[model samples]
Target: MLIRLKELRLERGYSMTQAARKIFSHPDTYNRYEKGIREIPLDCLITLAKLYDCSLDYLAGVSDQPRKYGR
Candidate 1:
């Protein structure tokens, strides 16, 4: 999941700091989320979904489909 987030961020040319700003999270905390060292909350998940145009299911690794559906 963290790897997926990292990949998406990199693909969008966003640095960790930039992503944190977009998500309204602290940069270091966002880094931990991306590293999987800390679990992300549901609210944060939803925010990330909006920011990245991805579904929570995809970020949670609950869906194998290319795009997440039916949260």
Candidate 2:
């Protein structure tokens, strides 16, 4: 989970601060999510999936496919 979040953010060339702003969160809080220090909320996870153009299953490490179904 931690690796996927950071990887997606980096793949998009988004700074932690920038990503946090997009998700309406504080940078420190967002950093915690990336570091696996805090549990991510469902809404945030959904937002991230959309923001990163990946499926929730991929973000959750349940699947290797990044693109969402029917995309």
What are the TM-scores, per candidate, against the unseen true structure?
0.88, 0.96
Clashing pairs in 2: none
| Model 1 bad stretches (over 4 Å) | 68-71
Local accuracy by lDDT, each model: 0.86, 0.95
Backbone clash pairs in model 2 (N, Cα, C under 3 Å; residues 3+ apart or in different chains), count? 0
Q: Per-residue lDDT of 20-42 in model 1, one digit per residue for the tens? A: 99999999999999988899998
Q: Model 2, poorest ten-residue lDDT window?
A: 62-71
Best by TM-score: 2
Q: Write the per-residue lDDT of candidate 2 for residues 10-71, one digit (tens) a residue.
A: 99999999999999999999999999999999999999998999999999999999999996
lDDT of 2: 0.95
RMSD of 2: 0.7
Q: Considering summed lDDT, which 10 consecutive residues are worst modelled in model 1?
A: 62-71
